[model samples]
Target: MPRAIGPVLVEGPVEVVLPDGTVVVSERPVVALCLCRRSRRYPFCDTSHRRRSRPSVERPADGEQA
Candidate 1:
């Protein structure tokens, strides 16, 4: 089985080349892909998190119930 790759710190999206010369694209470090590209989520901060705000509710989308 292939190992899970990374918490790879990068300034932008990176091309991950495998040992076999196959390349995989890691998720864009940006938060909102089309937005201003500044977000609370680091590496790429789209600033969308700044817009999607209700300070009274901190639970993320997964329903883990923060």
Candidate 2:
């Protein structure tokens, strides 16, 4: 059997196969995968959201929010 190493965080449905041909999946809306094996929570973003620092979008008076 091959060793599998990963902590992939998934926002949608996903499928994985182990070296022994073991399949893994989640029946939920969100999933987290581990990367460095340092995550105590393992996989899920522990407030590690990347900030773009994008300026606030300005909208025209006649324009509707998309």
Query: lDDT per residue, candidate 2, 1-66, as tens digits?
Result: 654344455776756565688776766677765544455543433433332378997776675655
Q: What's the true lDDT of residue 14 in model 2?
A: 57
Q: Identify the runs in model 1 with alpha carbons over 4 angstroms from their true place.
A: 1-6, 30-66
Candidate 2: residue 25 lDDT (0-100): 72
Candidate lDDT (C-alpha), each: 0.45, 0.55
Q: What is the lDDT of residue 60 in candidate 1?
A: 75
| Count of clashing residue pairs in every prediction | 6, 5
Candidate 2, position 62, lDDT? 72
The lDDT leader among the candidates is 2
The ten-residue window of minimal lDDT in model 2 covers: 42-51
Look at candidate 2 and give me any clashing residue pairs: 7-33, 7-34, 8-33, 9-33, 33-43
